[model samples]
Structures are given as structure tokens and as C-alpha cells.
Target chain A: MQLKRWLNNYVRIWGVYDMAYDESEGEGVWIYCEQEKGEIHPVSYELLNKGRELADDLNTHLTALFLTPDGSDAQELVYRGADRIYLLEHDNFNYPNEIPFRENIVKLVEDNKPEILLIGATHFGRSLAPRVAGALETGLTADCTGLKIEKGDFVQIRPAFTGNILAHISTDRCPKMSTVRYKEFDESERDTGREGEIIDIEPLEYDGPDVKILNEMIIEDINIQEAEIVVSGGKGLKDSQDFEIIEELCSTLGGTVGSSRPLVDEGWISRNHQVGYSGNRVKPNLYIACGISGAPQHLAGMKESKIIVAINTDPSAPIFDYADYGIIGDLYEVVPKLIKELREG
Target chain B: MANFSIIVPIKEVPDIEKVNFDREKGRIDRSSATSEPNPFDLNALEEAVKIKEEIGGNITVISMGPPQAEDTLRDAIARGGDKAILLTDKGFAGSDTWATSYTLATAIKKLGHYDLIICGEKTVDGDTGQVGPEIAEVLDIPHVSYVNKTIERGKDSIIVQTEVWGRLYKKELKFPGLITVTKDLNEPRLPTLTNKLKAKSAEIERWGLDDLLDTGDEKHFGIKGSPTSVVNIEVPKEKGRKSKIFEGKDAAKKMVEQLRKDLGGI
Candidate 1:
């Protein structure tokens, strides 16, 4: 991939303030963009959209770093709001192995010390960011719901206390860091015509042989994220038997099934089925909730689901606030009737 | 084929959740409560011990809190850590994520060589999930958070399996990596009596403001070095409402069918 340069002199505004302060005290913001098989994930773009504002507010140039295999699509990183792209490409990096990727990131960060680093809370970003932060001996915030700049520092804000509270944090010793969850903010349009500088570096290699993955099984069936129809239940179901009914309904509708935190906590469902702030964010064309009371934490996870339908005896349930269709009656009676009607219809 | 170094960050905070808050009094009644290692950090400790066993290496747990946090250090050593470091100073209080990250980065630098640092994705108290990444930033290292499995650790790199949306991803990163593991990473082991005995006299190192900065790095330490502050704190209101319980088997059956229909079948 060819590296491009933006040469935006506007960043010089912050440079002048730095001279007025202490030349030794300089900081910049970095965004960790994840790429796989020469493809930049959309989550990285979303993060760039968020990081751009933070960097601009902190008065620092936004740099995007992409780690991928050698001869991969590294050039594609520059068009995504990055003032600079640090590319580390290698054959080993073709498939993301945590050790090699993280080591390469350590080298990249040490070479370029940014004041604040933002990463998308995607699978790759989540797994890699923490270990690198630890190796560097820095603190990191994860799954940030909001971000802002206060007093020229990147203010990383996220939900705390089981999504019950919000906490704000900033770094002082330079290079503060945080990871933002997907869909946490709207993705800004890419300035495709905007060219930026890209620096290709060799991936850091580690020496070890203690672990190995013999093989992996790829299931092409279930695509929970992109499922067109989703059936989600919560703690309101109360028992395992109730779950069976929910499952039957999902089967009839040809939809995947999901649960609230309580179901996972109760071991009634695997965490894969959890739908909430700490769980999966789904946007099915049709989302159905059974017996769910609509706790904010649960809603936070599934509020994005389109055509939400809530079935509960409680007419004033919070789930109704965001739901388009509400059945203010017993789920048991309404469900069977609806099912028969659907079958006949 | 042997590479290992683990760093653990500790936090000591009041058990605000279980605290009996007197709304009218606008305070918590701290009469009956105790503190424990943040659940995620405890999981980190367990993961560290497992890694140490798999690949011979020393495990060090570090914390930047009050002197009382020493209890946590001792507990960590008791569990399975090879060493414990506590950086406690009154000036450290009210420090935001940035300051905390700064202090931790400084402490680890003072401690020296490391290959991998493991920590909880987020702490119970702060829950920002920033300290770990911030530390990575301060030291300028690579990191991953919310990992599910280390698919492989090769002589040259480590491959990991992490969850994204509803799918699992197998990715690789080089060594000297920092990772924040989730509770789902592994089932953390409980402490054994042998390790508990070894921990009793495990000379915990205590570093103060002066100890951290022989070079005046102290100027940008603790809350003073932190940029963001907690402008306001509010307890999230419980989403409670009127409830109705359906009675009888017929009612239960009806509810089941309705739920089934809601799910898209009968």
C-alpha cells in the first residue's frame, strides 16, 4: 500500500501553544484501527469519527495506526480521518495472532508517543489494547459511551457501576488511552479525497513456542449481528420452562434468540445470547421482547433493534418507551394466539 | 520458548453498591461492610498464575491507592503472585484515569523488564476500563481488551480469540504485549494454603511520592496531574414499576403461548 501525506499546517496552532508552555510537554492523540485480510473494518471508521473530535479538541493531530500482514491493504487506512497512519505489515500478521500484533503495537507506540490513544471496542481492538496498555504500564478505559475534551485534555467518559453511573477520566503523564464501543456514536462521512501520510514499519516478532492452535471450526450459519429477525427475552421469564417457549417462538419465526443479563447470570443461556450494554447490540428488522421489563441496561444493548415489540402484563414498562408495538396483556395468551394467526395468515 | 512477565493494577474503593445509602442524609452508612479485590482484577490474578505455571515467570501485582490497599497486595501475593508493589500516597486520591495511568506507568517503568502485562478489562469502582490502556499509552505498548482465549502463543507471536458482536475472531499480535482479560477469559483459581503461607512474609514493596520520582516526575503526579474531574455524581435510579402476577396453570399456559407467539411461533 502506498503511503500519503496530508501536510495539514493547521496543527501548528497547537504547536505555538506548546512553545508558550513547555516544549518538553507535547501530546498527540492516536487511534488504533484494526484491519483484517487487507480490509479496514467499519468500526475503525466509527472510531476515527469519534477520535477526530477528541484530537481536534485536545489540539493534537489525529494519527491512525493499522496493523496487518505484509502486502496487505495498508494504504486504505489513510482515507479514514488519519493525519498519519503507522502501518506494520508482515507475513505473520496475515492472521491476527495476539502476541505478534501486540508486540508490533508496543514498538509503534514507543516510537511515537501520543498523549491519548483511542481504539474501537471491536473484538480485535478489545483483546489487543489492554495487553499493550499493560505492557506500556498505562491505564486504559474501555467501551466508552461518550468522549469529550475538557481543558485541552482528552476526557474519556464511559458508563460505570454496571451501567448505573458514568465516570470521566483523563491522563496526566502524557498518552492517555480509551476504547470506544461500536455504534456508540454516529460514523462521520469519510473525506475520501483527503490524503494523509502513511509510514510502513516492520512488524515486531516474538520468540516463543509454548502454545498453538491445532485447528478452528468456522460455523457459517448463525450471523447474530445481521439477523433479520431477533427474539429477545429478559429476567421476566422467571424460569427455564419459559425459555423453552421463547425458543419455540424463535424457531417458528426463523429468528435467533437472545436474553437479558439475568438469563446469562442464571446460566439459562450462554453469554452469547446476552443483549444489553455489556452484551451484543442488535438491529434486527423485527425485534421481539417477551416478559422484559425494559431495564435501561438491557435497553442500552438492544435499543437499536428496529420494530421492537414488547409483551408484558405491565402496561407502563419502560421497554414500551422505545417499542413501536406494545401488547398490554399476558404474554402466554397473546403469544399462542399470535402464533396461530401467523400460521394461518 | 519461554517468555513471561505479568503486571497487575489494584484499586481500593468503598463498596458503594451494597452501601446502605441514606437518601435523606445524603450519605452511606458504613457500619457493616468489607472490601475485596475487584472481581475482574481477581480474575486477572488467577489468569496470571495460570500463565506463570504454563510458562515459568514471575508475577507482580501493583496498586496505586492508600496504605490500606496493602491488604489487597498481601491478598494477591497470597493467591499466587511472586511479588507485590504498592504505590500509596495521600496525593493520589481523587485522581482521574489520566493521573492513575501516569502513576502506574511510572511505577512499572521503575520496576523494569516485562514481556506481558495482564489486568482486568475494567475495575468495579472506576469501571472506566481506561487505566490499563492509559498505562499502555504511557509506556507506548500494544494491548488488547476483553479477550476470550489465547488460541496460540508461538515462539514469535501469540494468537488470541476474542468476541466481536456475536462472532469469534482469531487475531495475532507480537510479544511484550499488554492484555485486559474479561471474566469469561478463564475460570480463575482460588488461593491455596501453600501460597497463602508463602505470602505472609512476602516483603511487599511500598513506594511513595519521593520513591516514584527521584527526577521530579512527582510534579505531574496524582490528582494534580489528572485533567478530568468528576463534576457531579448521581446514583442511577432503579427502573421499577407496578407489577402484576398471573395466577393458575391456564394463566401460565397463556403467558407461554403469548411468549411463543412473540418469539414468532406457537
Candidate 2:
């Protein structure tokens, strides 16, 4: 029995090797344009922008798979750099449903056969991308921060092992798919003169057991990712109430209030305000770290800021190493002083 | 109400907090790190145990890892898992999320019957959050990700609240479905002394790739079956700054001046 099993494995390995080397017949770079409430998510444009570069490198057209409700137009996607738009219109597309979206996407992917596919790493995309990849039996790299066409290979780069290591991955399968985090790449400038073909496709009718959204509550908090300046607090704060100081400083700077993971885990602040590898990645114009010791995970989210200022009583704090300017003083003293300075100035 | 059978897939990962990076070598020093059950998976197990306690059912915990992962499965059993199965084999090494989910879905198929499959939002090491949904897709069942609360459990369905893009959604999913839970679900509980003792001596069921071949193809079992491969790994180099340090009462003032000069006023 052992020998038979070994033989089976050997044969299967060889079979897989043969299949892996088969040249892909797929064409074009595709971006899954996610939409909500009749508006295209901004990340879709970002993907289109990046997809255009990849498609250009491969000398192919950039295609945007726009699934939206009836009456929505795909012209904006063309303006964003898409050479062709495959628009699927359905009333069900107005809200997010995993099964129908997955079914339709899987069918489209099977029929069109794009060489590369990129989707936003938003909550909706993360849930939908994997199911589509699973149905197609293709590999998908999640939350990719970088993408490149290296020597005709579609390379997907993402942080792994708690953001300490960056892994560059390549797929040996067709329709190489990746989910890129929003804000990781810049969106292309709108070009009204750009021309593209819009092909409206029929949506798949899914009658399977589906998830029904009973209630939807849109959160009304400041999106820290879009903030120009961010004032963040960390474990250095003696108490949760000290967040008030952070808030004061943030408001004085007309910025958003952010916190490290520990504060969010402690329930002292909402998860939306947390900034780190596991939280919202922010690239604000100015970032003030109050009492943050600067763990690698935290740095991964905000290190791209144009200016970083660290305030910690400990001069040896790791945040100081990354901060453009460091101040060695208690946040209680320095923060209040800064708030006063900003208010007076 | 009839009792429901719950299956929770957990993973053992390197202790993220204690993981050491050899910056010069551009690699992680795995030898210096201790392994622990992925924290998010613990939340999954806790939710499963809570569901079983409320509805009176069996909870089976499954994990795919090396032989050392048995310890993690034992830990799960101690925490409230009724039965633990470890999917360990040399052939399973180097499996990415696709192959891993396929193997797990195959093992789940061989488990006969289950009402629900619960998993952590994502593993700390990979942080992909793809396996749970991928497994559901392989099994052809409905799933919800980032579920934070269970509002109601009906005879044939479950109502859950999930968070997506800073929005809250209350969704109801039919039975025989899957759900990936977030950290906000519930606080995990410690094991009793009796349960801890029992789990220590418990005989964990071990299933190798051979055991799952009846339901899954051998080509889809490991690296050979994986569609994606890592071509290179790099440790991001830390960019140095001016590191101008200031102190005393006027420190804040001096820092403001420097920021104004460099940034053209804050």
C-alpha cells in the first residue's frame, strides 16, 4: 500500500509539473471595480492606474470589470485608464452580497480569461476575491503592497510574518490574482480624452443559500486614512483618559486622532482609529506620535508619512529612530505645551 | 432545538510579539521565537465552545501544521474542544492558502456531518484571512467574514453581525455555512484543572495526506499543488532620519521650530 501511494504521488507530481509549464492563453490585465451605493470605490481607480502600467508593460489592454447597479456608467473607469470595461448591471449589485458577486465574477473570469487580476483589499474585496480564486483553483496573494511585471512575470509583493518580512510571490497559474490594500498605490489622473469600449454583460442569477443583510449601519467617524495630519497615542499614555490630550492635539492641528493596536485592543478606542499593520495604513502629511514607542507593526502603517515627530520621555524609544524630530519629555508636559503653542500661534 | 455540530479550524504560529528579525541577514530568526496558537484562532475556538454550551453540541477542532502543532490542538481541547484532529504530514509542507484550504476542506468532508465551520479572521503569520472563505467556496457553502457578534441562532440558520469598511452589518446565514470571527467576538476562557489534565493525556487523531486522498487529489495536497510560490523575501531596511533630540520645558518649542523650518510650518 505504501509503495502504491508513493507511486501515485510521483505520477501526480510529474503531471502537475507538466501542467504548470503550459503557456497561459490568457490576455489583458483586469481590475475588479468594486462599487457601493452607485459609486465606484476609489481603490478601483488605483488598481486601474496600476493595471494600466502592467498592461502597458505586457503590451495588452487594461480591462475593468465593473459590476454595478443599473443606470451606472463605466465612462469614469475609462477616464481612469481602462482600455475596455466589462460592465455587469443588476439591482442586487447595489448592496454587497458574497455569493452572487462571487458567482458572477467567477463566471466572467472563466469566460474572459485575463492574464492578471487585481482587486482592492477592502472588506468586500477580501471576502469576494478568495471565493472567486477558489472556484477557479488559482493562487491569490492578499493585501499586496507592491506589484511589478518582472521579465514577463507578474510579481506580487506583500508583507508577511507580522509585517517584518516582504515576500515577492509569483503564480504559475492563469489569471494571476492579487488583492491590494487601498491607498497603497496612487490613482491615475482623470483623462476626459481617453477612449474605451464598454461591454455590458448579463449578471448571473444566483438562487443558492445566500447571506441576507438584516441591518446596515454606516459608521460616522473620521477616516484616518484620508486625514492630512494624524495625532496618535500609545501605551505611554498613563490612562485611557489621556486620549483626551491626544484628541486636543489632533483637533488643534485639525487632524484625525489615531491610536496604536494596544489601545484598540483594550477597548479604549474604536478599531477604526487604530493604525498599524493590522490596522489602517495611513500616509498623512504630518504624523505626531505621542507616547508611541514605535513597534515595527505600528511603523508599517505610518512610516510613509511626509513628516514624523515622536514625543516620548525615554530618549531610547524606537520611535525616535524613525522620527524626523524627537523630544525627550513626558507627553503630559510636551503635549499640553504643544497644544497651547498651536492654539496661541 | 436540536444540537449542532461545530468545527473550528485553528493554526499554530510563531509568537509575533517575541519574533526576532535578523536585519543584516534579511531573515527572521525562527529559532529565537516560541510558537503559540494563533491568537485570533483562540477567539474562534471560544465562539465555538460558547455555541456548543448554549445549544449542547459537539465541538471538533482541526489544525494543519507540523507534528509540533499537536500541542496547539491539545491546548484547544483543554480550552473546550471535545475532539481534536491534527492534519500533519511531510507532503503538506509549503502549502499556500489555496492548497491549505483545499486539504482542510477535504479533511472536513471526511468528518461526515457538521452544521457550521468557524475560523479565525486570519493567521498572524500570513494575515491573509483567505482560508476560511476559500474553504467555504471549496465546500460550496455560504460564508461571512469578520463576524463580530452572534445575534440569534435559529433551527436552520444563524444571525451574525459583521464589520466591513467601518460599517456594521447584521447578516443571517443558512446552516452548514462557515464564518470567520474577529477579535471582538468574545473573550476566551481558561480551562478547568480537570479539562487541562484530560487534554494533556488525550490521544489526538492524526490524519496524513494519505488519509485524505480518498476525497482529494494528491496533486492538490502540497507545494506541487500550490499555484503561488515565493521567489524572494526581503526585510525592509529602516530609513534613518535626522534624529534631532530635544529635552526640557522648551523641548516642545524647539521641536515646533524644526518642524516649521523643514515642513514650512506645521
Candidate 3:
């Protein structure tokens, strides 16, 4: 089959044809190299870094695939443990749109089949992966925090039951795909001594208008992913109206406002604002939570935040145990006073 | 407009979380592992049916799981797919994402004439959201995941809204494409009584590796083909202690003082 030949060619490119033919477990794995603003996401590096270990264990060549539009250069290609980098570039891919992004990825798979594929479980990864899996008629696990090779198979480990349990899912089919959460693994230390083959391919052409990128509303606000200061609230704020206090304090302190699952449940904010295992994982310089009881599920989301500040009326609130700064007071009274003083200064 | 052939990849997952685990033994004694249509996959099926209504095409529901997964395919048929395929075989067990995607891709190619593929954003069990994109990687197609809304569908491209870097991108995507929908896409319809009966009697095609992957490379077909594996299972240590329940004004006063110290005097 053309795919088999293509795989062989790829193997030869890596100078690891023997490994690909003999040791590559299952089919092979496709690693989606995540990038933002033309720069690869750190998590992408981490994935490749970890993927290499996985590929080697399974005797497979770790392959990297980049999906970007025209005007970009594939100069950053590296083996980083990858056997090959499938470079796909097109003007349509310059900006990330689910349709075109996924379309191009699917095209690569159709052309060269890999047994497994790894994607970072970032916002883009979470948004783009499922569609591609659907297209391939396969299974996918999301936000996998761990991965490894077991008995010649890849075991995709992910948090399940609202972070209450860890589920290990495996498919009997080739190319078992899963996304790894950011910060789950360390990025491979850059070792220039290592090198791999890079393959540049023509972008897949489909007749219909590849989706138009109408607007790129860049939030000037520090991305929560990169923010050093975060002030989050929970359902205890009660209503949309109460969120003002949390927002005001955060604004005063020049920090971003985040929320626990309760806020999303209360419909006080969008899911983007949510913090927990189900939401964003943040590690900021200072994380202040007002009126959050710090449920295990909620703590699982933000425990990594460097310095935590907890304010609640309940002295026994779970949030206190994790807070570097614990306050026992009415958040209603405390937040406003804090906001006023910060403004005066 | 040409009739678009839509394929909805489905899954039947054990409600493993709901099953009580014997902590002493640390095993899922799934005497209670109830199977459900993966919540998101159900949403994918619903979206496929909705698209079928708007686009006028056959919606084929397909899944790769144990034979028991046939129940889910029948459920999809009842919900409104024109046909269904269940890719199952004893050899297809303990597959990782790589092998899973490869097998499914082979099956899809065998099904033939699929214009669009749709899937749920993520399954409840795995929650990794990798399989979809991995499949896209294997199929070599463009893919979009976590689609919030389908704004418009052009003859050649479909316009959709999805989040990128916390920002929503509304753009047109070409047809003969693939997309994964989130629960927010639409409300799923319950199966009709008559349709349920029809599905119950429907002959779901059960395809094995020989039928689906006759041309697939043996190296990439199943567990032996996967690369990554879990090193070990260590339960993350619980980070915080239970909140100490405080009572009344006295507790409130003590709390405020603690706050003053943390806030450096309120």
C-alpha cells in the first residue's frame, strides 16, 4: 500500500528503518507540534520530549507534524527524539481554525498512517483533536496527564470521574490517539546533538472555502496560562452581581479573574473562567481565591498556583490548608476594603 | 449540491466511575460498570443527525469496540443514522491511541465515500481528547475540534466558531472535511419509540480486522503497534486537609484576624 511505502520512506528518513520495521509498536504515533504566534507551545516540546521515550520503548520512530499556514518557516524542526517531522504549511493554516486545522491533519494521516498520535491538551488541542478523530473514525482520550508503553502498547492515562480517579484506556486499533495536559511532562532538554528527518508536503486541497479567519481577538489581558497573578472566585460569590467584588479586587491588584467549577455551574461566567481539573491548570506567582472552600476537585485545578490566598468565613474551609495567606472574614466586606486600599495606594 | 456522506464515530464506555471500587483491592469490580453512550459521542451523533437533516445525506454511525458496543451503534441508528458499522475483533483489545486511530482510519477508508466525519469533543472515560486528532493525523485530513457552533455551510466550505487561545475563530471550512462537536453544539434528541424498535431489529454490520484493515500494515494495527504506555499508577496525594468547621461570631472573629495577618492588616 502507498501508506506502507510512505511509512518505509519515513523510516529511512530517520535512519531508523530497522527500528520502525521491527520495534515500532502498534502502527506508529503522530505527534502534533503545537505552536502559538508562530512559536511552538512549550507543551509541544514536552510532548515530543516524552514521546521520544515512548517511541523508543515501543521501537517506533517518534514523528512530529506541524500544521501551520503560509508565511511560516519550518526552521525549528528537530529530532528531539522524533524520527520525522511532517511539515504541512498553507495560508489557510496560518491562523488556527478548527475546520482547516483538522482538515490538514486528517489529510496527513490519510497519506501516512501512524499507530498513535499525541497532542497537547491545551485550549487548541482540546478544541481541534476530537474533530480529527471523528474524521478517522477512531477513539480519543482528552486531557491525558500521563502516558507510557506497556506490554508493547501505549497506555493513555487520564483523570476521570471529575479527577476522582485515573483511567487507563487502550484501543485494539492502530493509532490510539490521546492529548497530554500541559505541565504534565518536562520538555526535552534541547540536545542539538540529536537530529531527525523533516518532510515537507503539499497542503491538502479541498474544494470548499477553507474556513475564513474573520477575527483574531487577542485578549490584551495576560493569558491565564501565562499570568503571574490570578484572583479567582467560586460559587460562594452567589450571583453574577457578587462577581463584581472579585473582579474589582482583581482589577485593583492588576490580576486576572478566574473561577471554580461552581461559578460555571451558577452561570456567572463562561467555561473559560473555570479553574479545576475540568478547567484550566494555572501556576501563577500569586493565586487568590475568595470564598472558595477548596474542594479536592477544585484544588486539583489550582494547587499548582505558587502562592495561594484563601478568604472565607469558615475557619475550617479546605482552602486554608493550601493557602499561603489565609483570611477568615466575610469576603463581601474584605474584598471591597482590599480593593479600596489598593486603589488609594 | 452533491449529497454529503456523513460518518459519526461512536463509542460505548463503561460508567466506571459510577461503579464502586474496592479501595482495599484497588480494582474496578465492575459488577456495576453500566455502559452508556459516551456523553459527548451522543452529542456527536445528534449533531450528525442534525447535519443530515440540513445537508440531506446518509449518516453512518460507526464504532470500534467490543461486541457489546453494538448496543451503542443500534442506539445511534435509532437516533437517526442511515447505517452503522461496528469494528470489533478479539485482537482489538488493549490498544492505545495510536493503534486505535489506525484501526478506525482503516475502517473508515473501507466504508468509502465519507464526506464529513464528526465525533464528540472527548469521551468521559479517557478525557484526553487525543484520539480524534490522532485519527485525523492518520487519515491525513484537516480537522477542527471543540466546535461551538456551525455558523454556515458553503458548497465547498463550512463556517464554524471554535476557541483558539481563548479566542473564538469564526471561519469557513471546506467540505469533505472533518469536525468534532461539543455538547454546546446542540441539544440531543431522545430516540423515538418507533425508531427504537426499528433499530433493535436492524442488522449492524460487524467488521473485523480482515474486513476493515485488509490493506493496513500489521505493524500499526493493534496493541503491538502502539508506542506510549503508563509507567505506573500512583494516586496523587490529597493536598489539603478537611476544612475545620468554625461556628458563630467567635469563629468569625478568629477568622477575620487570620485574614488580617494574611492580608497584612484589613
Candidate 4:
């Protein structure tokens, strides 16, 4: 106990974590406000609300780390939930390039010494957090779905081995970090009138190292993450010829078209269009399962939808148990008619 | 010098099926679970092996798990690992990804001389996919993730393709960097009888915390080295869907009508 106390005092004296670690007593919790082309990502807001809860529990403030090319997100970040905002603007930061982003974020955490750092487990964050954690010599839990305070420290809970199991993990050192998966937590309330501070930090000139983006191959598809309604087809669609029904219905419904993993395997759809344990986890208001047998793996992704409607030839399909609505019939006959009727109505 | 010097990090995760969450206790039950090499890591190893095949090179595989995890190392040997190092210690328990990365990074620095490090985007069990970049960060190397294809390769630099939704980023990175490959990159090769025989006799190197951390601060090694903690874990509670069943030809119209009403005709 004496040695532990000594180390605790040493951590504070050394201020190695920038006030982040005084052992059990934390400085604050910070959330990275992620942006794409100027628009803030939804996950950032979700994290802010969640981070606020954590900070409040610890009697600490919640700060926002906004690295952007412009001040577009700076104002909104304050109105959301952050008590303080660290806004860094730079040309390289316009895109969440791993190199400059890592360098800057690591410095921010080190200088500010927030005891906890939360990032969205989006493509960019996944790449950036590990690099930051590595540079800071701190622990970062990735893709966490649950976070809470235990004995004055934050505990992160995340899915392990894909969607199979949940692991409760902790970072014993200061600046405990975690990258939260999208849709893991509901977006919290935002009050535009909520006042907060925005500290503008000069962006250090960053010439990125070794890696460079040479070119890009673009394919337009629905942004499944932001979609409110998703219509998914499975192997029962048989082939692309039958998949047309799903597409047409999706278009008529003004929603995105998603598919089960089997359809991707059968070469009927691209991997991005897949929604399952191995694919996208969609939390749309309504998820329509057409000719899909609700495999547990498939359910792992979309079972969180607000309303599930399953259409299958088998009435005994496990999907019915989870679906708010069920239709027993072949998808081919049902989809075209549904599209035609919806188009008319 | 070898054409290419590489390291692949592997993990032995509990079987996906055998994993169960105890909501009441806020824990997972894996006692009945058999362990297997994290499938994603195999993809990384496979990609590294293919690169080595294209040009003559040596590959060193590393892992930090229990003693049983050594079996995963031998399997990597079967796949194409020329050297295997295992880091295991009682203090390493519940190290989380950061500590795990630290322990692994320490081992890598100790082994020295590596042109590249390949990792699965994530492990089946850890599912964090943070270690590869973390190691690169600790080593101060650049990293790119979600590469589905490698377009070009050479001794000093390489180009790869990242296929995310709506766009595929063709990126170039100089050597002595790290990459986390996805399954879409390539199909892994099955171990041949000869490689299996070789793996059976190949010796495995084991390192404990004492061997890795020069600072010798036990607190900076495993559970102690970690910063956060797991407060609780439970299976996500899924609300029951609306109980409305529709059937026959009229089902389509009726469902659409109901949806239009519920969705405010979006």
C-alpha cells in the first residue's frame, strides 16, 4: 500500500500524464470530434453524451478534441455536450490521415492530460487511436460498446471475436482510451444553448511520413450507417435476377438496400452491401428481411433495429421470433407487388 | 540481407460458438471453449507469406497469450513463419490491447531488424484491431488499415488498396512500416505435410515480463500497466419487435400501408 501510494504521488508530481493520473483521481474525459468534409460524424455526438456521463460521475469536466481543417465543427461541438473544446486546424487534418492526426492527438492528450479519451471506432479512428495510444504509451480499448466508472476509473466493455462475446477490459494507466463502435450507444440530447469554451490551438505543420494516398477508386453506395430504414435480401433471393425485386422495393421505400452474408458469398452483392456479424451492423428504424432465414450471425448485426419485419417462405423461421412483423411467402412475389403498391400509394 | 524481414502477430481466441455472456455476473464463460488461431491473423500471416514467396525473405511470428498459445505459433510456422516467439507471464493476465501491444512491441524491438509488420485488422477475441498500429506508433512507423489488395511491392516501399464503402483508397507506404490486412486480400494457403512435419520439430522461444521490460517495473507490464478497467459486461438487451404478421398477396400492400403510417411516409 505504501509503494502504491508513493507511485500515486509520483505520478502527480511527475505530471507524466498531464494531470491525467493521480491514481483514482482523474483530470477529465475527452472525446474526439470526428468530421468528414466539414460535417461532424454522428458517433462523435454519441460519445460526447456518453463521455459527459462518465465525467460527471468522476466530478470532472468533459472536453472535446476537434482536429479539423475548418471551424465548422467547433461551434456545434460546444452546443452539444463538451465543457471544453481543443480545436486544432490544419490542411493535413482535413482528412483523418493517420500520420499527422496521430502526431497531433498524442500531443494533445499528453499536454492536456485527460484521464480518459474516447474515439469513434470508425475507419479513421481505428487507425488513429492505436497510433496515438502507442505513442503516448497508454492503453486503448477498441470498439467498445459499453463504458462506465468503477472505483473512480473508467471501465470499457466491448465485443470480442467479432460479435460472439463481450469482454470487460480496463486500462490501469492514465489517459485510458477506448474507440467506441458506431451505434453502440444512443445519441444523447444536445442543447444549442449549452455554452462551452473553444480553445483554438495552432496547427503544427505536418509533412506526413512514409505513406501517401496515390489515387482513389470510388463506388457510390448507400451510407448504411446513416440510413433510417434498411431492406435486406438473403440467399432466398436466389440470384441477381431476384435481387432486383429487393432493389426496386428499396428505391420505392426510399431506403438503402442491404444483404445477408450469403448473398455476398454467392456473388450477388458486394461486401459493403452486407449486413451481418461479419458485415455492417445496421440500426435502422425498420429493417426488412426478405427471404432471409434469421441466422444468429445475421441477427447479431441488425437485431438491434427498432422494428424488424421478416418475409420468408418458412413461417417457422427463427427470424419471426425477433421480427415485429412477418410475412410468409416467396420474396419474388411479395417484393415486386410491395414496390408497385408503394409506388402507387 | 534477407530479401524482406517480416513479423506477424497471432492470437489464440476461444471458439466463437463456445463464448457465452453472463449478464447477471457481467462476464463471459469460455471454460468449455476450444482455442484456435484468430482467423484474421491467419490472413495477415498469409499475406506476409505470399509477399515472401514473391521475393525471398524471412518471417518472424510473435504472440502474447497463455502457454497453450504456443500452439498457435507452431501453426504460424506451418503457414510460413521461420521464427516464433511467445511472450507469456502471470502478470500479463487481463493486459487489454494496450498492454498486449506494449508486451508485443517490446518483443519486436528486442528482436530488432524488421522491414515490415503485418496484423489482422482485429483478433476474433480481442476484436480491437489496435495492436498493429499501436506497435507502429511505439516504433514510430506509419500504418495503413483495411487494405484489401496490394498493388505494387518493392524492397523500400509498397502500394496497396483499401476498399471501404463507396471508395477504394490506393495508398503507398515506404518500408519499415506496418499494415493490417483484411480477409479480402488473399486466400490463405493450407499447411502442407512437409510444413506440418517441420512445425512439429521447430523449437519455440518463450519470453516473460522480466526478459522484455528493461525498466523492470512490474506495474508497467501487464494488468498493472493498464489504465482503464471493465466495470461490467452484459448481452445487449434487444427489445421484442412489433407483433404484426401479414401473409398472402395482400401482405405486400398491407405491410407497405402500415409502414407508411408508422414511418410518417418517409
Highest lDDT scorer = 2
Clashing pairs in 2: none
Tens-place lDDT digits, model 4, residues A265-289: 6778877788977678899998999
Per-residue C-alpha lDDT of model 3 across residues B169-234, encoded as one tens digit per residue: 776556566777776687789999999999999989988877865657665666665554544444
How does model 2 fare in lDDT? 0.87
lDDT string for model 2 (B50-111, tens) is 88878778999999999999999999999999999999999999999999999999999999
The best-first sequence of candidates by DockQ reads: 2, 4, 3, 1
Question: Per-residue alpha-carbon lDDT of model 2 for A1-345, expressed as tens digits?
Answer: 597568657856667332222336778899998887678889998899899999999999999988888535699999899999988888788777788888788778767778898999998899999998888788999999999999998999998876777899999888798999888899989999999999988888877548887889997877889898999999989898889999998888889999999999898998889999778889998999999999988987898898999988888888988888888888888899988776666
lDDT of 1: 0.68
lDDT ranking, high to low: 2, 4, 3, 1
Q: What does DockQ give for each predicted structure?
A: 0.22, 0.74, 0.25, 0.58
Question: What would the per-residue lDDT of candidate 4 be over residues B123-170, giving only the tens digit for each residue?
Answer: 766567788887787677888898888988777877998853236788
CA-based DockQ, model 2:
0.74
Which candidate has the top score in TM-score?
2
Q: Write the per-residue lDDT of candidate 1 for residues A1-345, one digit (tens) a residue.
A: 122112223333333221012213546778877676556777788888887887778767888887766535555556667788887766655555456766777666666667777888766666566666655445566777778876665666776644555556554344566778776677657667978788877665566322233334454545566577888877667687788778777886778988887888778887777887556677777788888988766786677665677778787788877776666767677666556545554
lDDT of 3 by residue, A1-345 (tens): 597678768876774422222223345667898877566778888888888888788776778888765424344547356668888776666567566666678777755668888888787877676666655545566777777787876688876555656667665444577778888787887767777777888876755444456656665444676676788987568678888888888876667889987677667887667777556778876788888998866786788776677878787777888876665778887777666545544
What is the i-RMS of every prediction? 6.7, 1.5, 5.7, 2.9
Off by over 4 Å in 2: A1-23, B1-3, B260-266
Better of 2 and 4 by lDDT: 2
- Kindly list the per-residue Cα lDDT of model 1 for residues B229-259, writing each as its tens digit: 5554445454432223334544434544544
